[model samples]
Structure formats: structure tokens, C-alpha cells
Target: MLLSLRGVSKSFGAVHALQDVDLDVLAGKVTALVGDNGAGKSTLVKTVAGTWQPTSGEIFWKDQRTSIRTPRDADALGIATVYQDLALCDNLDIVQNMFLGHERLRFRLLDENAMERAARGTLAELSVTTVRSVRQLVASLSGGQRQSVAVARAVMRDAQLVIMDEPTAALGVSQTAQVLALIRTLADRGIGVLLISHNLNDVFSVADRIAVLYLGRLVHSGDVAGYTPQRVVEIITTGTLATAAT
Candidate 1:
């Protein structure tokens, strides 16, 4: 397992965001987290990304327990999160966006050539071919192309685990397919992927494992092949397995 959460919980004053939640993300596989609104999915992601500290429980990276108290701590551990916003500057070009905060320096100055070369190399490694050039502005790219850039940026930072939130939420059919294929490619490259999506079709298409969260607790988690879409919906809505209810 690349990442594991055991008995993790988080609270905000009077409200409990997560309670005794357990989850695992394996290298070279996609683990899809599915749930309705207020199901604690966001809370769990925030906790893992170091945006919020867990109230109780342990986080294990590579089977060794560790603490992730801040986003820097998570990044140092090779955990990168791409939120729904993508966080890319519209005015900046691809190379600038990729190395926004971690620009390479040459003689006390930003190395534009080196940065561009590295960005192109990383995109090539990920087999991203939509954007015409690395110098293209982010606003000019399509929805899927923008997603590819965001993911490539994460990979360039040496992220071993990439957590993506609603990566295809606003994309059309073709764009959604493109992003989903990109996700599979990422897993094939041995990077653990945690995908949070509300789309069941997307989940079934890419997830090796599906975990359903209800309210603030995990209700079901199993291989994707073990449950049908209807069964998954039942689990998400009622917090019970179909067989158990039957």
C-alpha cells in the first residue's frame, strides 16, 4: 500500500467531519472514493493532503506510520493533490504553470530553457499530446488538456500518490474519455491514484477498488468487479450492502 488511513477522524467544533474512517491506496492502481454530499469524502481528502490534521488515528506511507501536519509535509512525502480548481494561472503558459513554485535556478535566475525542456519531457513521459506546445497559455487549452497539464505538473514534482477531485466534472464526452485514459496511464506508471468522483460510469471505468462513504463513515470498500453500479448506489445511499439488506 502506498497510503493507508486507520481509524482516522476529524472534527470541526461541534460537527464531526470524519469518524473512524479507514482507507487504502495501492501503487499502480486507482482507488475511487464515491459518496453523496456531506459524506466526509472531502474531509478525508483534506486530511490526507495535510490541509487539516486528523483528530485521531494513524496515517501510514509505504507501511511506515508518519505524520503529515502541513501541505509541505505531504509534498515531501511525495503525495500531491490536484483539487477541482486545478490551481493553474490562466495567464501563465504550460511551462510556467508546471514549475510555478518549484522553478529551477541557473546562476541565481529562472532557467527558462531548462524549465521548458523539463516540462516537455514530463508531458511526453505521460504521453500527453493535445497541447500544441509547452509555451501555450493555459486558457487556450481545452478542458482535458488543462487537466493533463495539472496532472503532468504533479508528476514532475515526483509525486508517488496523486489525489484528484472530480477531474471530469465539467468535461464533455470526448474530454472525459481523454482524462480517464490519462488516469489509467498514470496508474500504469506505478503511481497510486486516489480518484474522487460522483460519476458512477467514470468510477466503474477506471477504479480497481471502490470505497463508499456514508455520512462520515466508510460503509463499503471492495474490488470494483465485486459490485454492480446499482449495488454501489445502494451502498452509498443506505450505508448497507445489497446482500445484507436482502
Candidate 2:
């Protein structure tokens, strides 16, 4: 397993966001995390991203018990999160956005050629071909292209596990397909992808595994073949498979 959560729990005063949640994400596969609103999906992501610490329980990275005390810690562990907001600057070009914080500097000067080459290389490796030029400002790109840039930036950072939150939200059919293909490409390249989405069609089409969350608990987790769309919906709403199975 690339990442594992054991008996992970989170509480806010009298409310519990997660309860003894145990889950595993394997390398080179996409695990789709499905849930209704307030199902502790965000809480779980935040905990793993180090935005908030778990109230209890343990997190394991590559079988080593670890504590992700901050976002930097998560990044150091080769974990990258791409939230709904792409977090890209509109004024910046692709190379700048990809190397924003970690720029290539040589002899106290910005090595623009090096950064540009690396950015283009990463995008090409990911099979992203829609953008006119890496020099194009982010504000001019389509929604899907912008998403591609964000994902490419994560890839360029050498992230082993990428946590994507609602990556296909607000995209058109073609754009969704494009992003889905990119996701598959990520898994093909031996990177673990934790995809959090409400779209069952997307999940069934792209995910190798499915984990359903209800009332802050992971009700079911197994191979994608083991779950039907109806069963997933039932679990998300009712937190049980008895009726759906029957």
C-alpha cells in the first residue's frame, strides 16, 4: 500500500467527522472515494493533507507509522493535493505555474529555458496536447486545460500519490473525458491517485477500486467490479448494503 489509514478519527467538539476509518491506497491504481455531502470526505482529505491533525488513530506511509504535522510534511512524503480550486495564478504561464515555488536557478539567475523544457516535458509525458503554447497565460486556457496544468505541476513535483478533489467538476463532456484519460495515464505511470468525486459514471469508468463514505464512515471498499452504481448510491445515502444486495 502506498498510503494507509488505521482507526483514523477526527472530532470537533461534540461532533465526530471520522470514526475509526481504515482505508488503503495502492500504488499504480486509482481509488475513487465517493460520498454524500458532509460524509467526512473533506475531513479525511484534510487530515491526510495535514491541514488538520486527526483527533485519534494512526496514519501510515509505506508501512512506516508517521505523523503528518503540516502540509510540508505531507509534501515531503510525496503526497500532493489538487483541490477544486486549481490554485494557479492567472497571470503566470504554464512553466511559471509549474515551477512557481521551486524554480530552477543557476548562478543566481532564473533559468527560464530549463524550467520551460521541464514543464513541456512533463505535459507531454502526461499526453496533454490541447494548450496552444506553454507561454500562454493560464487565464486564456479552457477549464480542462487549466486542470491539466495543475495536475502536471503536481506530476513535475515527483509526487508519488496525488489526491484530487472534484477534478471533473464543472467540465463539459469532452473535457471530462480528457481529464479521465489523464487520470488513467497517471496510474499507468505507477502513481497512486486518490480521486474524490460524486460522479459514479466517472468513477466506474476510471477507478480500479471504490471506497464509499457515509456518515463519516467508510461503509464499503473493494474492487470497482464489486460495486454497482445502485449499490454505491444506497451505501452513500443509507450506509448499508442489505437492501441493495437483496
Candidate 3:
């Protein structure tokens, strides 16, 4: 496993957002995390992304137990999260946004050429060819194009594990397909992806594994081959298979 969580739990006062969750993500594979609203999906992603430390749990990276107490820590461990909002700077161009904080420098000056080359190369490698140019402003790009830029930036940063939250939300059918293809490209290049989404069609399209959460607990997790859309719906609704749902 590239990343693993054991006996993980999180709490806010009397509310338990996650309870004894165990999950694993492998390099070069996509793991889809599915659940209904308020099923602790956001809580789990936030905890893993370093937005919040777990109340009690163990996180292992490549089998070594460690604590991610800050976003920097997560970055140092090669973990990058692209939240639903994407956190892109609309005013900046694709290259600028990609190298926003980590801009290249030469002789006490910004290395625009270097950054542009790197950004363009990363996008090309990921097969994001819809953009006219890396110099184009992010605001002018379509929804799926913006998503492609966000993912390209993460790849340029050498992210080993990318956790995406609702990546295909609110996208048109064609745009959604584009983003889903990009996700598959990530896994093909040996990057681990943890995709949090409510869309079953999208999940079934690219995920090699699936983990289902319900009411702060992980109800089911395994290879995608073992689950059907119906079984997943039942688990999300009643925390069990339909045959077992009472």
C-alpha cells in the first residue's frame, strides 16, 4: 500500500465524524470513496489532507507510521489535495497558477521561461490538450479545462498521492468524461488517487478499488469487482448490503 490508515477516528465535541476507519491506497491505482451526504466523507478527506489532525488514529506512508499535523507535512510526504473549489487563481495564467508559490528563481529574478516549460510539459504528459496556451488566464478556461490545470499543477509538484474531492461535480457530460480520463492518466503514470465523489458512473469509470462510508464508519471496502451499483447504493443508505439491510 502506498498509504494506509488504521483504527482512524475523529471527533468534534460529542460528534464522531469518523470511527475506526481502515483504508488503503496503492501507487498506480484509483480508489473511489463513495457515500451519502454527511457520511463522514469530507471529514475523512480533510483529516488525510492535513486540514485537521485525526482525533485518534495511525497513518502510514509506505508502511512507516507518521503524523501529518500541517499541510506542509502533507506536501513533504508527497500528498497533494485538489479540493472541489480547486484553489486556483482565476486572474493568473495556467503557468502562473501552476507555479504560484513555488516559482522558479534565477539570479534573484522569477524564471518565467523555466516555469512555463515545466508547466506545459506536465500538461502535455497528462494529455490535457484543450488549453490554447499555458499563458492563457485560468478564468477564460472552461470548467473541465480549469480542472485539468489544477491536476497538472499537482503533478508538477511531484505529488505521489492525490486526493480529489468531488472532481466531476457540476460538469457537463463531455467535460466530466475529460476529467475522468485525466484521472485514469494519473493512475497510469503510477500516481495513487483517492477520489471522493457521489457520482457512481464516474466512480465505475476509473476506480480500481472502492471504499464506502456511512454514519462515520467505513461500511465496505475492497476491489471494485466485488461491488455493483445496487450494492453500493444499499450500503450508502443502510450501512449494509441490501440483503442484510433491515
Candidate 4:
């Protein structure tokens, strides 16, 4: 496993956001994290991303036991989380946005040439072909194009594990398809992808593994071929289904 949470739990005073949850994300594969509202999906993702430290748990990266105490710690481990908003600057162009805070510098100034070349290379690596140029402003890009840029930024930073939250939530059919293909391309490049999504179609479309969280606990985790949409819905609502493999 590339990343795994063992007996993980998080609490806000008396409210237990996650309880004894365990999940594994393997390299070169997409693991879908799914659940209903308040089902601990966000909490788990935040915990793994180091935004929120687990109240009690162990985070294993690359099979060694470790701790994610902060976002920087997670980044040091090559883990990047791309939320639904994408957290992009609308005024910035693609190259600038890709190297926003971590800009390359040859002397005391920004290395525009190197940054542009690297951004273009990362986008090409992801097979992104929508944008006309890397100099285009982010605000002018489409939803899928913006998403592709956000993901490409992560790849540019050499993120080994990319955890995306609802990457295609607001996209149209074609845009959604585009993002899904890009996700598959990411896994094809041997990156571990943990996709948190509410849409089952999107999940089944790109995920190799599925891990279901229900009310602060993991109810199921297995291959995508093992569960149908109806079965997934059943587990999400009731915490269990007759066909659930546990």
C-alpha cells in the first residue's frame, strides 16, 4: 500500500468524526472514498492530508508507520490534496499558478522560462490538450481545464499521492469525462490517487478500488467490480448490505 490509515479516529470534543477507520491506497491505482453527508469522508480526507491531526491513529506512508501533524509534513511525504474549489488564483496564468508559492528562481527573480517549460511539460504528461497556451489566465479556462491545471500543478510538484475531493462535481458530461480520463492517466503514470466523490458513476468509471465510509466508520473496502450502484447506496445509507464483503 502506498498510503494506509490504521485504526484512525478523529474527534471534535465529544463528536467523533471518525472512529476506528482503516483504508489503503495503492500505487498506480485510484481508490474512491464515498459516503453520504456527515459520514466522515471529509474528516478522513483532512486527517490524511494533515489539515487535521487524528485524535488517535497511525498513518502509514509507503508501508512505514508515520504521523501527519501538518500540511507541510504531508507535502514532505509527497501527498497533495486537491479540494473541489481547486484553490487556484483566478488572476494568475497557468504557469504562474502551477508554481505559485514554490516558484523557481535563477537569481533573485522569478524563472519564468523554466517555470513555463515545466508547467507545459507537466500538462503534456497528463495528456491535457484543452488549453491553447500556458500563458492563458485561469479565469478564461473551462471547468475541466481548470481542474486539469490544478492536477497538473500537483504532478509538477512531484506529488506521489494525490487526494482529490469531488473533482468533477460542477462539470458537464464532456468535462466530467475529460477529468475522469485525466485521473486514469494519473494512475497510469504510477501515482496513487484517492478520489473522494459522491457520484457513483464517476467513482466506478475511474476507480480500481472502492472504500465506503458510513457514520464515522469504514463499512466496506474492496474492488469496484464487487459492488453495484444500488449496493453502494445501501451500504452508504444503512452501514451494511447483504452483499457487503465487510
lDDT per model vs. reference: 0.95, 0.95, 0.94, 0.94
Indicate the residue-level lDDT of 69 in model 2.
Answer: 90
TM-score of 4: 0.98
lDDT of 2 by residue, 31-143 (tens): 99999999999999999999999999999999999999999999999999999999999999989999999999999899999999999999999999998899999999998
How much is 45 displaced in model 1, in angstroms? 0.5
Runs in model 4 with CA error above 4 Å? 243-246
User: Which 10 successive residues of model 3 have the least lDDT summed?
Assistant: 237-246
Off by over 4 Å in 3: 244-246
Best of the two (1, 3) by TM-score = 3
Residue 94 of candidate 2: its Cα lDDT?
A: 88
Candidate 2 residue 236 Cα shift, in angstroms, is 0.6
Writing each residue's lDDT as its tens digit, candidate 4 over 1-246 gives 899899999999999999999899999999999999999999998998889999998889999999998999999999999989999999999999999999999997999999999999899989998899999999999999999999999998989999999999999999999999999999999999999999999999899999999999998999999888889999999998866354
RMSD of every prediction: 1.2, 0.9, 1.5, 1.2
lDDT by residue (tens digit), candidate 1, 52-109: 9999999999999999999999999999999899999999999999999999999989
Candidate 4 — which pairs collide? none
Worst 10 residues of 1 by lDDT: 237-246
Encode model 3's per-residue lDDT on 1-246: one tens digit a residue.
999999999999999999999999999999999999999999998888888999998999999999999899999999999989999999999999999899999998999999999999999999999998889999999999999999998999999999999999979999999999999999999999999999999999899999999999998999998888888988999998758532
